[model samples]
Target: MRHLMASAALAALVAGTAAAETPKDQLIVAFNMNNVLTMDPAAITGGEAVQILNNVYDALLQFDDEGRNLEPRLAEAWEIAPDNMSVTFHLRPDMEFASGNPVTAEDVAWSFKRTLTLNLAQASGLKSRGYSAENADEMFVAADPQTFVLNLPEPGDPKMILMYLTQAGIGSILDSKLVMEHDDGGDMGQGWLTNNSAGSGAFSLQQWRSNEYVLMTRNDEFWGEAPAMKRVLMRHLPESQSQRLGLEQGDLDVGLSLAASDLKALEADDDITVKTETSAGFYYLAASAADEKYANPKVREALRYLIDYKGINAAIMPYFGVERQRVVNSKAFGALSDPGYALDVDKAKALLAEAGYPDGFDTSIRVISTQEFLDSATAIQGTLAQAGINAEIITGDGGQIYGAMRAREFELLVGRGGGGQQPHPDSNLRALVYNPDNAQEAGLTNYQGWRTSFFDPELNGLIEEALVEPDQAKQTEMYETIQQMIDEKVIPIQPFSERVVTAAFQDNVQGLMVDPWTTRFEGVTKGE
Candidate 1:
């Protein structure tokens, strides 16, 4: 009924414009903008908010929409020191903010410094690398108007360092003068910039009604070629059916968040194209090591065979995510081939017997109530039952489900695997498996590995060793070894499907980014 209501309203708008075709000057993209909690780059979480910022901000460097290679953006070029302890970037001159102030080295320095000082969602990437408020001044240095220096704490790969900064966290440079002018009681202008933009990107935030829609207008003074669309509208349509209806009725140009069924139906419909991209992150089954039932590594290994990977991908996960068993995202370097393990009930039973659970046991799987997660958990429950493991499912919204997972209070959980914030292997590995401190009092639960209480001192050592290794070839080898180690160790969390972003858009809406991480409307053009 919610979908029907949204669809009916959009249909009425279409009826009002019966003679006009899809507007070429504006693009209406409807998606569930639940992840867009804040527009402030310092505090924004997840890929959805970053994608929105991509339109309004320019990073010093950015992974292309494909997220395969890092390319220069705000900065024209950069050079790394032989010791790999510092990188100096040469910024593109004659650049101006949307407010028409010159983008200087001071703005670049202050922008990054402010993020760390605020210590919000983006502070982890730098803080984890030994950069702190005390050291931030020494770390981020501005050489001149067009020159900037980022000093590393130790020797590391320049490639990975550049890749790390490519994330919206450290990379989204702000206009120092404009933002500071809007500062309310030293709040860093976060409150004001929440609805406004201060960057020099192709578009500027015009208006944003939380959980409703965000409206953006093209910046005529953009340094690069202006986007074809004069205005961009991202509507908050949570229901996939409503998005599909809007697209079919020509009310929406692109539907960013659609269910797998919606994508399948749209593919069969005329004047719509469904595009899927294997993006960062994964949907995985996690067994908490803190639970006695899952504490045994052998039990975790046995449970891996109970999943029907192919069946899930074909019938349920397509256009939602893909079957990928590798711990790291396949798009990252040194990602090993999937160790194909078909569902073997007998093998699972045999392993259970060997682990002294021949009679099997009862467990509950926790999952968010989203359709795809619930569907996957239901399938897993059925398979586990076949192996004599009676599993009950506990479903809730993200906060309720993931909140428990974060508090280290679940025996089993089906949750999304984060990392893929950047294309680097360390980015995924660190988030998924790296946990240096393990004591309950340590409060290191932010990491998935730590949240699961899956701690291995050696694995932690390897992660740190890999980060500082200046040799790319050697570092890649170390990561490959770490990947194998995690797999062989039966690292409590097992990834089943790599996330894939699927969207249905009008056939004439060209260059829509499927990867939510790098999505932007700057290059999107409408055609006949």
Candidate 2:
């Protein structure tokens, strides 16, 4: 009976392998995520959702594989007005959305208006300079169906405004007719088009099985070079172990969010190819400044000193790319770096003493329930413990934890920030740290109620100046000052991690380009 059982198990494994290796026609990419809220290009914000959406939609402009700005899908040529407040785009007249409807300036205007409205409603986490609801209504006046004009309130900096439009969350243009036709009237809300996309992108969704798989086929009517692959199969494998196993067993051509430990072993395999890029993002701890104990600057500084970033990076991600002192890209927009605080246990202790907590304080570190974040929080807990700080680690669902952070439910929390292509420091500060309006219930990225009078005024001034300044020299100087200010004050501590690490079977995959600013799928192709 034991021999028979062993034989049966072996045969079962073989059968699974045969099924997994069925064909190269469907490009199965596994990701550690559950069912996404919506696949609509505009409404999608989470990491996994973006990955799936990129496969279906194309933006107005695209970032090259090297992270540089490039033109590909929608607009053919663009010119900025002499005063700098306006931009004119000549659209590609032949393009059409997945619905077979022509892509026009009206669609672009409608999409911009929807984003502006969503931003005003605080329903979506979209940010753009000179493109708010009020201005979008006035600024984006369509002169004709194929010609688009943007009139800025003030003479705006074209590059910065361009940066805003390129954000993956807002760049996708939706068909106005489809959106109006599909309003669901609930939390997913009156935008059927938000959950379902109709755009002039590279691929179109053929089938989506909730929590199971999403299948996409190349858009033969694409304006540019048609992809060589036939289909893209995205499987939701929420378990990290399962995703890793799928990659190893040749069942999945690509796997995302693989465990840090699994990366080393995967890199050793000759059949698989691995690539990683320094994410323009950071992992950091958010302490509730509203909390009585943490409101003290001394307490915050003490916690900063206690963190052993070097030790944590070495243990957690040995192949970690960068070690950030302040927030990632702290030097981007003229923010100052704080030279006073460094890794010093004794200094942390002394600061704790100065803060009226000589015995050290006990607090909880809240984190989203994910294996990757949990591992990172556990390492931090140990590091802080060594400094005499008692950190109780708590894990909960991501939505619940996000709400808790907003409600100031925990003393400290582990979170990440800066996931856009805009390399400017002002962009990061305004969206994540300085702007208080962003903390409103409707705002998307501002979970932590971080505000300081000094930083707030400074950021506002920078934005005002950046909008009008066309001189590259002056813009660079202003951004440097911004970075210097933020870094010196220790507003946020930036830790580093490999941003993009994806592997796929080399045999059938080609044009697998990853964009640093946003995940893109324009060039990806599967075997013919």
Query: TM-scores for all candidates?
Result: 0.92, 0.79
lDDT of each: 0.85, 0.63
Given candidate 2, what's the lDDT at residue 453? 15
Error of 1 at 321 (Å): 0.8
- How would you encode candidate 1's per-residue C-alpha lDDT over 1-528 as one tens digit per residue? 997885564454434235434578888888788888888888898777877888998888888666878888889899888888899999998999899999888888888899989888888777877788888888889998999999987566667778877766467889988998899998999998888888988999877879888878899878888899888878888998988888888878888888777888999987999998888789999999999978888799889999988888888888878889988888887778888877899999999998889989999999999888999999999999999999999999999999998889998899887678667788788788988888888887669989999899899999989878878789889989998898789898888899988888999989888776788788899888
lDDT of model 1 at position 54: 84
What is the overall TM-score of model 2 with all chains considered together?
Answer: 0.79
Counting only residues 3 or more apart in sequence or on different chains, how many pairs clash (N, Cα, C under 3 Å) in candidate 1? 0
